[model samples]
Target: MNIELVPERQYQVFNSVAGRHHHHQPIWQNIKNLLKSCFGTQSDSRLLNRDGSLIDINRLRQNINDKQQSYKKRHITWPYLLNIYSPSMTNSDKKIYQNRARIRYNRLKRTWQERVSQGDSFYVTLADTILKDVRRTDRHIKFFKKKKQILFNIMMTYSVYHPNPGYSQGMTDMLTPIVYVFIDESMSYFAFCSLMNRYMSSLFDQDQIEINRRIRLFNLILHSIDNELWNKINVNEENYLYVYRWLLLDCKREFYRFNHVLRVLELVWINSISPFVISQSITNYRSLFTIFICISILQEDRQIIFSYSNDEDLHKYFFSSSSSSRSHRSTKRILQQAQINYSNYILSQK
Candidate 1:
């Protein structure tokens, strides 16, 4: 029983069972945060255990149900939960994952360092846009203020890889909380890639249809979760601008402290298991859950949203510099409401 092992079998078993039971969610979430500290939201692909057994991709597919259904029904005091042979591992395992993550991080940095030493950004065309966003993104945060160039380069690198739309305005807003969380540029970039490629690609899509598609979906989400607000508001192009801003910035402006923003961002990133692997078969978890998050913000500020006559006024209502307005809104309330909204939408779909 070497505790320092990254057993693929145990990880698979943990994946199959971890968050299924509601009672386990509190501890499970803590474990997940600890893992994120080591892995930076990137799924560790070293899927071999002490016995040299390989990972089974088929078993991983059972997760959508495990995530949705397990919380619906709680099974307490099972042998699986109590057995010493369960999926739980040790701090040494954390050290192993952390070490590998550093290796990956350093390797990526070396490659970038070589290119940087040669004065090659490879994002020459897109640098201007990325730079402008980086300059003004988060000046209040000391790290963001100091590492402006690094943030600029990360977005530039992303542009070089994903040249479709190159770069957009609010993309930096999406990157801010991620960089803050990972606190390492290389891991942050990879984590950012996982997040964007997951369900957020649409918001940056060129045809502009996908962005609109998300707006339409938002209306459906709003209708489902808060019909009162939905009925009160007119669903038109004018209001779509509001939703567009929300999608682009990922509701970062909704919260006062950046920690609250990190919580929501991690909420979207945590449910995602295969961070590096993009699969069409897996349901779009980020897409659906993100909508619920937006709705939660809107629901929290329902009175403010309705009290204002125009979008301009409502925009100022939430985004105003007065931190008090945003501070009162609880992160727990936002998350709990989001889950409730998601559950309602899921039940309605069935």
Candidate 2:
């Protein structure tokens, strides 16, 4: 069977099973209600405000307090910093407790060291690279150092937890935005893992099967959309390596703001719309939507790309273009163009 058919088959099986399990409706409905309540029915205008000014600290604090109260009332197990910081040891018992804790910490440290030694060298190199680029001069030096440490810890913990795909070069880039948003290392780690498993698991596959599959799918889509441009590039699947980082990191490095990346990711996560409308009924094509997004991005640069006469020029263009942050489009525009292109492509197929 074609590898591409697997996702479609899985979707079909899932839908069939879901149809039979009508009893699950209430559970799903409850989950939807919970999410709506947690996130609110309408988007918060304060967060969405694009004005170039400092955030209203008082409003932010109140929003956080409201969320905490809601979570507490609903008995949601939110991790509190106090739980990690507060010690139960009394003045008299402090010595004994300290000794026990030191012993436990030593054992864990030794185990962690052993695991780190056994981890992939490539991941270690990537982790080190991530740490080097983790901070910016705009932030306080000490605060930036602390954030780098938190990021390092999160990457190490995730690598240990997922030993098979231990770590990949782009994994750190993927986690950076998540860690920045969550702030708390533990929460960020959990969110990173969830995202990896849900949307980015393939990118880390040892066999490179999933990444290659997506690349091929992307090539086909590009060809279908504009064979002239596709042929002009004069590259095969291997030459399309330029797109690997984009897909793997989900354009995290491309976008200027982390919030913009988050917005794009949220839409990608939804995966309700299909790139090819003709094939929409056959499969949701959820996994291929990112490729469609890439196509949309490429569309923005099509004219510039067409100007290149040779592969070297094109390769250089791609390499130098990373810092061309001005070219990055708004999340809304990217999403709209992607949808429009996908719909047109689907119609063309018909």
Candidate 3:
């Protein structure tokens, strides 16, 4: 193998598997967040404008708004997980799929094949939604590939609807799973765009104010938990660059390990709509506290982290540890303990 040559086939194989697995957590979390945000007392109390006007957070949740609910139920069944996979499941399955990309690609190919065979013209609307590269830029062309045309179209529609945001690099990653699930490309685009409008304010911002706000929130959490760690990292000075992308994109780039990524995503999704319990004191904070809870979970593994300085070692530990019974149990326990103390300290002042 040429050392410098791009492993296009291997890349696609890994991405397909990773994408499919990653898809589940976000969908489940989004649904849970939608429901909890609507029904949960904590979140309902917090969703108000600066003027104290109520925000209809529930409007963002999923429901049987139309015929789509029935359709959603059909595709989201459990058995479909096994049914979707190729027959030749093996240890080297990813390699086989490199020769022929499995699952999602097969699904996409099948859908495309059916549309072509039926002579369906439904794809035209989807094509129109794709934004023209008016500048005809090479970067745009490279970023938006043929495989991602549908994703691009949907994101383009999202951009138009949220004219302030227009388009951004991270938007495609957020929307891809939505496009894959809806099957009816056009409807999927609209739904995903709508869903995004609720939570994606930072990416489309002129000043990236929301990103800054979240970073502040994280800093507050770090101060509350481990003042020493906070000072050591010097977040204001940009020492913890690793977490910058994670917080900004909400962990999309860092979470190649499917299960752990899904776990974190699910936690956020469930918490999203619930009103953030702001601290009553000047010391109070928001979502970043939970991020500290996550970091504390990793604290137990800090020795292992230090032991293996390479990226692969860290990846292996994060992935392997997430699936281990003891580690998962420990993470849950730490989260519960931290939340109780943090909540008491915050709520007592009010």
Candidate 4:
């Protein structure tokens, strides 16, 4: 019943039943087609998402007119996951909207920037801890060379609002691709809040029980796939921490820039909206899908990963700069593979 390792092949569409398609298709197209049903077969044409919101067809289209009108818009591209939930706005309205958002962005930016000087114990404490993590996390937010302050401000603002598990170490890793995709602090912050509130909050819990449980599930599923590979890579139980890092950070630093990570995230969010998961009331689907993604990536580097007998070598092979650039696999293909992996895991259980 074990899922066998897959060799490289042409990209396939994600499917739980067939696991492959006869012809190749753009990943976005499949996701777009599923908009109406991802939430489930509602009697109304109104497609619902995680929060009972309607999906906007026009925004999903990224229509030619909208693109033409907003050539000079702040975000040149809108990620599908973010756009699906965003309100439709004309160019003029978007300009006004962004201007207002810019005002708020600046206000928060300065408010947190003052934390170092204000000497307020609370803000100062957050400021000191935030700055340390920001410095390290900023190292390879490749698209964020000059905008580290924006990253800092977003985290600071989030900390102020959420307070629980505010500004954890790996949060910056999750936020970088979001900010890059939205290219606007306000949109990024809002989207980040949504993700934290629903799908990914478990990763941020201060206590370790939920985190450990999920990692245990990851190890359990991985062992089910192949006990030998699991035992090899998971020596000393270190791969649990590695998987935790991947899950918590969205594996953000593992690629050339944020593009791969964003695509990976796009797939993750797509799963969050999946009818099978949502209709079945699978509250932990996001964490579940993300674990499959971790496995997909691990399986890709299997040959090289297997060569490394020790955790340290595997660690470098995973996170080292040279290793980062080593992935030639399409993000879409990896995601499709995850679909197969998840399906096979489910079948094996039965």
Candidate 5:
């Protein structure tokens, strides 16, 4: 019957044990207080009676276990609505679903065919370009041809799905690297769709509002970043045409490696952490990243660029569709430098 009270300082020991055992502090504190009140003194054993006798520790443990089990059982079942509403469709429902699915399938097929029929010349050009890249002795020649068809199908499907910005010229170039990376037709299609929806949709706008907005933004960003180079280019509505294609196709035609082109596109898409507080509206235009990237690319050739005496030279140098093989820096190097330069510029703005 020798019962001792838990000292005030000994609460730390109880807390430490509770922490290690993951026991709730309130429960453990309540148990301690009850023992103290009942016994009128501290006890070496946590479970005890008022008469200084040991209580059934097993019963207390069982009570807590039962409460937890009951709580979990009540709260962790399938959602009420799901339980009430069976997902299993009736025969009639299944028939209706199949009919709707069939209708959608027919519509999509019809739309895809219509797009293909309209863009026959573009498809032919695409096929020729695809075949030109594939060497006859290459192991994946058949796969390459298959991929070309998949790419064309993806473009047509995208055109059908998105009629507002229905298929544009550079779309095939944009989708080329996407199809190469995501080999599965459906995966490639969706990825291409996502790219278009998120970034390149503006380029295909019928009214050219998005296109003009982007061009203006690009000029704004370039001017802000480098007024000297911006002035040298002296870009106008007519002269910025090459840049339109570059931005629209994500510089796919410029870069050598398809993977490198895709890497740059994704980097632009991610819009990584920047030092400056960009406005919400400004951030909405994902193409700003490419604009900054263009600035970076231009900065690499700043010496040669500044030396250009006229707009035509500046245009040919910076915005030309020609291969960038002559460019000294690698795509990765240019991208890294772009990020660094952007971060520094933002920091300066702050």
Candidate 6:
């Protein structure tokens, strides 16, 4: 169970059971596939057969055309503005729609640029982290680097292995930190793969298993720790959902203290003692403490959170709370309580 120390082959078997078809591949191959998928041609069919033949091209085209017509009628497009200038639509409406489109596209472009830049940073930082850890004198660092390389090769070969779930922005986000910490590309890759295999089913599809798992654990812990607050939150049906941002990024987006985040991760790893801790915590009672910890953090910043009615304020609060000492203390208390409950629960189970 000490995955960090076990032989590579043992975990290789565990990985296979977790549904990975490849544990090794060339770096160039993964990069090639990623490029192809991003820029290559794609199918236009709305539906497809088992073998991938188009099932409804005409209907799909018709649907697209209908939507286009609807946009025209609603004065929501460039053509609609042309009509307005030609006296078909009023000047006021024309200016409004054009401005809206310009504003929307500008915003979209800004977001795209940011994600692209972040993705680039993530890739470089991850690669550097892996290489740096490998060069360190620690013996664990060396072995970990070997394993990480295997995983890296596999990821590079992702297109040939799991074509349907090829590289995603989130994948890079998940991989970067592991590579930095572990230094072995293969080990980091497998660790990340192990994690993704266990939790990412909800990511690419509509299956709510992962989300439900979080909600259930959140409810269980809230019910255990503070029934009064639990009842209040439940009445609003917003316990786990309120904490969605934290879960989505593994608390990277929420916690300001890197050391604190690592401690929480260690607690989670120890509590569930499962590699699939993120998702498993959703169903395990011990995960309740994790949610409680989150609530405690937020409650300490109640004024900051509730004071903000819009995104700008929320963003400001997020940065502000990251460095706040008061909130950090509450987080530590929550973790301590979680440990007490976890110990009590284990004793009772035995």
Q: What are the models' TM-scores?
A: 0.62, 0.58, 0.46, 0.67, 0.56, 0.42
What is the lDDT for 12 in model 3? 81
Model 3 per-residue lDDT tens digits across residues 158-183: 55446676565556555544444545
Instruction: For model 2, give the 10-residue run with minimal summed lDDT.
Output: 74-83
lDDT of 6 by residue, 3-80 (tens): 256588996786576554444444546867886655542332233333333354344333432332222222222121
Candidate 1 vs candidate 3: which has greater TM-score? 1
Better of 3 and 4 by TM-score: 4
Off by over 4 Å in 2: 1-146, 235-238, 272-286, 325-331, 344-350
Candidate 6: give its CA RMSD in angstroms. Answer: 23.4
Q: Report, for every candidate in turn, its global Cα lDDT versus the true structure.
A: 0.62, 0.58, 0.46, 0.64, 0.57, 0.46
For model 5, residues 1-350, the per-residue Cα lDDT tens digits are 58688897797887788788865777868979887655554322333343323355343333322222222221111111112112344335535644664465456656547654687776456444444433221223244555655665566666656767776666766666555554545545655666666566777888887777767777787888788877777654566676676666655555655446656655554452232245534544246567677777777778887787776776566555434533455776677777787667667756
Candidate 4 lDDT over residue span 122-163, tens digit each: 888887788787787747546687768778888888888787
* Candidate 3, pairs of clashing residues: 43-274, 43-275
- Which stretches of model 3 miss by more than 4 angstroms? 1-147, 180-183, 277-290, 293-301, 304-350
Please identify which of the two predictions, 4 or 6, would achieve the higher lDDT against the true structure. Answer: 4
Candidate 2, residue 231: how far the Cα is off, in Å: 1.7
Error of 2 at 69 (Å): 22
Q: Candidate 2 at 342: error in angstroms?
A: 3.0
Candidate 1, position 41, lDDT = 34
Residues 68-94, candidate 2: write the lDDT tens digits.
Answer: 223222111111111211223233453
Candidate 3 versus truth, CA RMSD in Å, comes to: 20.4
Which is the better candidate, 2 or 3, if ranked by lDDT? 2
Give the worst 10-residue stretch by lDDT in candidate 3.
Answer: 77-86
* Descending-lDDT candidate ranking: 4, 1, 2, 5, 3, 6
The clash count for each model shown is 0, 0, 2, 0, 4, 13
